[model samples]
Target: MFMSKNEPVSSPEALLQQIDTDRPLPPLEQWNPDFCGDIPMRITRDGRWFYQGGEIRRPAMVKMFSRILWKEGDRYFLKTPVEKVGIEVEDVPFQVISVERTGASPECLSFTTSTGEQVVAGKVHPIRVELDPLTGEPSPYLLIRYGMEGRLQRNVFYQLAEWAESHRINGRQVWTVSSEGVQFNLGEG
Candidate 1:
C-alpha cells in the first residue's frame, strides 16, 4: 500500500489490519534511508510522544506516526513509502503500557503498546529484560514486530513480575515467565 505522507492517516486498527500479523512487518529492517536530521520528535521513557518541545496531545497523531516508526541501529525514524526522518528517543522507542493474559489456560500473554499495537508473548513476540550497567535496574521489553521492541512501563513490568517464577537455568537461578508453553527468563534472581 503506497501511502502519501500528507494524506490523512487512518485509525490504528486500519493501520494494523493492513499489516498482517502472520506476515512480516513492512520491511523496516531492510530500509536504509538517509537521515533527515532531527524532527523535533521524541518518545519519553514513559511513552508520551512529543513534537517541537510540546506533547503531541492527540492520540490520533501519535497513532499515525507510530505506524511508520522504524528503528535503524540505535536511532529511530519515521518512514513512509518514500520519505524518512530521524528523531530522538529519550529511552526506548516504544513502551508497553498494559498486559492481558488470554488464550487457553491463559498461556498467551498480550501486551498493548503506547502505539496501540497488541503483541502476544510467544516466539514472534518474546519478552526480555536487560539490566542497566550503571543502575543495575531491570528493564523489560516485549517484541513489537520486525526488530522493534516496546519497553514495558514500570507498573507493567510489575504486572509481568507477578506472573514470573524462579527457575534454575544452567548452574544459576533465573526469574522466568511462561506463555504458550514457552518459558522466558526475565533476569537473574
Candidate 2:
C-alpha cells in the first residue's frame, strides 16, 4: 500500500473505522514508513495546531491529525503506511485538559486530553513530574498512548496536587497520588 507522500493509502475515515472499541487508537505501531522529510505542521505548547504559518482552527481536522502523530526519540512526525513526515512540537503532543476521579476507597484518576481522548492514570498510564532546575517549577504529564505523553494543564495539575497525599520518603516530605494501587510522586512538599 505504499504511495507518495501526498497520497494516503487509506482514507482517514477508513483508517478510523478500522480502530476497534478495545483499541481506541489506530495501530500506528504496525506502520513502517519511509521518512518523507519535514512538514509545515507544528503543535504549539498550548496544544494549538499550525500549518505553514496559519493556525489550523478546525477541531475535527486537528484531532484527525493527532491520530497520525508519532514520536521517535524526541522528534515528532505524522506517519502513515507509506510516508512519515516530521513535525515540530513545542512541548508534548497532547495536553491534558481535565481529570476525573472514580471509585470509592482507592480512587482512580482518569484524564481527558484536549483531543477528547480519555486515559486512566494507572500502572500503564503513569503520571510524572519534572522540575525546572533553576525555578523549581513543576511540569506534570500523563502517559496517553503509544509512548506519547499529555502535559497536564496548570489547573489540571493543581487539582491532582490537591488530591495528593503527603508522605515521608527517605526523610523527605513527598506529595503523591495513588491510582490503581500505583503511587506517583507529585513532588517534594
Candidate 3:
C-alpha cells in the first residue's frame, strides 16, 4: 500500500540500499525493447513511498511502479502498469526544462519532485530531457526526472538505456513521443 503523510521512514540510504540488495535484479533482456534502447529514465524503489523534502514532517515514500521514457526524435511517453491495486497513485505534471546526454548516458533537470509535490500536491511530474555526449551532439537520451521526498534533498534523474545496461532489465519495444531540446552530460566527480 502507499504510505500516508503520517507514516515514518527510517533512513533513505539504508532503505534504498536494502531494497537494492533484496530485490532480484531484472535481466537486461527482460526489459521492454521499446523502453530499452539507449536512453535514461528515472529509477525508484518498486514498493517504497516518497515524501516531501523539508516541509514533510511525516514519513512519505513514492512507490515507483513504472517509468516514462523521453527519447530523442519522438514525443514524451509513460510506461506504467495497467493499475496499482492498493496504492494511491498521484499525478504531477512536468515539463522538459533542460536535458543532457554524456558519458555513455544522459541526465535531465526540471522542477524538483518535492517542489512539484508541494505545488502540485500529489501528482507525477513530467520527465525532463538532457543531451547525450557519447552519441555525438547533445540529444534527448530518454531520461526522466522525479522529485524524491522524505530523505532526498535534490531531484533525481533516471536513464533507461543506462539502467538496462546496469541491471540488465529487459522489455518489449514500444513507441514514445519526442521533443526538440539540447543535450548534456554529468562531469567527473
Best by lDDT: 2
Clashing pairs in 1: none
Q: Per-residue lDDT of 97-123 in model 2, one digit per residue for the tens?
A: 999899887789989998889889999
Indicate whether candidate 1 or candidate 2 has the larger TM-score. Answer: 2
**For model 2, what is the error of residue 183's alpha carbon versus the real structure, in angstroms, after optimal superposition?**
0.3
Every model's Cα RMSD, please? 5.5, 3.4, 17.0
Question: How does residue 47 of candidate 1 score in lDDT?
Answer: 81
lDDT of 3 by residue, 1-189 (tens): 222234433344343343332243223223333332111223232212333322222222222122222222223333322211121222222322222332322232232232122211112423233335586322222222333222122222333223212111144332222112322222211
Model 1 TM-score? 0.77
Candidates 2 and 3 compared: the better one by TM-score is 2
Q: What is the C-alpha lDDT of each candidate?
A: 0.75, 0.85, 0.27
TM-score of each: 0.77, 0.87, 0.19
Which candidate, 1 or 3, would have the higher lDDT against the true structure?
A: 1
Q: Tell me how many clashing residue pairs each candidate has.
A: 0, 0, 58
| Candidate 1 lDDT score relative to the true structure | 0.75
Model 1 lDDT per residue over 13-127, tens place:
5755555444434666566655545566888887888877888786766776676788778877887555577778887777888998898874888889876787888887888
